[model samples]
Target chain A: MTVLGWTRHRTNLPSGVRSLHCGDWTILVSDDPSIQTARHRLAAQVSCFDAGLDFLPTAPAQNIAIYDATSFTRTTDLDALWRKLSDRGQFSVAVRMAADQEHRTQDGRSWLKTRQAQRQRQRHCGTMLADIVAHLKLPTTQPRHTENSASCDVLVQRDDTNRVHNAMQHLARLMQGPPDMRLCVTGLWPPFGFVDLTSKTEAAE
Target chain B: MSLALEMATPQDAIRSSDTALVDVVDGLLRHGVVIRGELWLTVADVDLVFLGLDLLLASPDKMRPEGITR
Candidate 1:
């Protein structure tokens, strides 16, 4: 199963380096003179095919992007740290994964009402759903199908709920949610977690 | 596209808020699906660093925001 994942670059990676899939997950490896040395360890006794980082999709629909801020020694306060990042034009990293999927629907109601309104408010949602269905209908479509030499699967992430009972509420929404024309959330998964900013080094090659 | 994506990008109105990043990462860990890979690293440092400490950063509050050079 092909999995999509991502991570943020905490420091300036060496020039010409990208990312790599260490195992089922993606990781960053150096592209220095001993490239093969790094490869030897990562590829050791592995049966899976390694999809180099250059091909990773930065787009949310295509990949699971991650944003980490725990390495900063500048501040211990989460709020202050976030503010510092924001002041310096780096705040976007935090929202990189869910930003595109979140919707703002105008309704005289609470969060639930706003979320419910998204289905009716956006014209493209239907179109997108149709496109997904069309993609799935392809005779070659399979959970592990590789199209254009790239793995394909139903990409889903959370942007619907953020309250105390987010899980239950989301599960409820999933149970009674509107019928999606073509997308399927369940199938083979690659876990997408191994992908980190370091993989970018592999892409540079 | 994932909704957390837009929230993570900085252009969103909520980007500047203190909890926006927290909320986005939280949403990702709780709802985001890593189609493949054994372990997904969501922390910025671990993703960039060649280490296996992502689990430690799962608690968003514990992660410190490192500055970007460019």
Candidate 2:
């Protein structure tokens, strides 16, 4: 499984490795227009989910996470773009997993502890989302109505029921807000970023 | 006079409930279009924990725990 796309941090790509993943998900960074167009169109296919108020589930049979720079440029401003693709977001996900799960080793203890601390800070922010929702009570909308940002989207295979459900719920919660702060879920998508790394690694050979 | 909890303090006048801090935090927590392929993008979400650290460092005078920075 692989996510073919572009990244702003192409400088960080590992030697002989164009894509990267921690588990069932893989990310590919690129700035190609054709790829970006395909990604944008994919977002259009799945228009029921929202970015800020929903939680995304796991990938389907074979999932991929693609990031294209051309698409990211067409959507958001500089600050928002940088923040959207920054390692900060990815890091948060990792830390969250560690905190939510109890898998820790002595050698990885320091990293684990630091991640836990970070998770606490982020949780503070996430918990406050309730206040933001109460104050704004934003409407739920499709991507067609709003301006695009990072062309944010997710695609899951038809059989990947668990992941699809999880992604939908997660995205829904994050999409909450007032009308001015509407959440944009493009449409149903094809699994592009969700993939089992171990499975793929074994297949690559 | 003490500051209202609802409102940020004078020193943090630039800070407001409407601030993008949390949004930024959320985006870092879970934003960006993800794809899987031979060309992969490995983003360490824990790296965003730095945002909290940055927040704490910026307001050391407040002397809050990493958790309270949010």
Candidate 3:
């Protein structure tokens, strides 16, 4: 059996889901090898978030993810926060992940020129990353990044949704990243970075 | 004696109002965790190949946007 992820209960199981009981959670598993089944479970996991149920997903990380109700913070407040700010009650604004990466052209006139252009775009993406870190007040060293590509997943504080969207979108366009990189302002998701895995570690001990 | 991959990036018109479409793609595809490690490929319950792999799941449109990159 291959493990997919952990959930607080056996509430929302997709096809082939095998629930393994844990001290405070259930491990969702599959009969297929981890590779084949993880993808199927991921698609199911994306669509659903219940107020009463909490889930921990996988990175081929397996179902043994040690989870307890206390280790994770609920962003259900995020939806309420977004609703108060914007009337978009169905959706929320705590987009946990923001990605910006170098842009490239499919075909170009010259290799030298394309390489130069690619590097320029990368610098812009790097700058955009720096801007995001500052905007969110995310604590990190090397406040500026000049890498060829960058991406991050972080918890957003409850600020105005439209403000962050507009600010990011504006700066992204000004930075002139690849179309998608310029355009990618993702939506609210489970707080992957914020959760603690002490339960998993304790289980191992 | 050469191979090439060419993909047209989507310049589709997306209003600021419909960030939902873009958001859905980002959350479902980009946000999904990737599996990276060594593996054994087997057939008929016998291991046939060794694989060192990093795997990500996404639709063609999302993965091929512009071109492939890490």
Name the candidate that leads on lDDT.
3
Give the per-residue lDDT of model 3 (tens digit) for A39-117: 3444334433223224554432222223322232231222233223221111112211123233354543243344455
List residue ranges in candidate 2 displaced over 4 A. Answer: A1-36, A40-106, A140-205, B1-70
Q: Rank the candidates by DockQ, best first.
A: 3, 2, 1
> What is every candidate's C-alpha DockQ against the true complex, given to 2 decimals?
0.02, 0.03, 0.03
Q: Chain B of candidate 3 versus the native chain B: what TM-score? A: 0.26
Point out where model 1 deviates above 4 Å: A1-15, A18-116, A122-127, A130-205, B1-70
Each model's number of backbone clashes? 54, 78, 0
Task: Evaluate residue A12 in candidate 3 and report its C-alpha lDDT on the 0 to 100 scale.
Answer: 60
TM-scores for all predictions:
0.20, 0.20, 0.41
Instruction: Write candidate 3's Cα lDDT for B26-48 as tens digits.
Output: 43333234544545565796555
The positional error of residue A148 in candidate 2, measured at the CA in angstroms, is 22
lDDT of 2 by residue, A65-145 (tens): 333222233332434433333221110111111122333445544655545554454444334333333333322111100
Evaluate residue B18 in candidate 1 and report its C-alpha lDDT on the 0 to 100 scale: 45
Clash pairs for candidate 3: none
lDDT of each: 0.26, 0.28, 0.40
- Higher-TM-score candidate among 1 and 3? 3
Proportion of native contacts kept per candidate: 0.00, 0.00, 0.01
Off by over 4 Å in 3: A9-18, A29-38, A50-52, A60-110, A138-149, A156-181, A191-205, B1-70
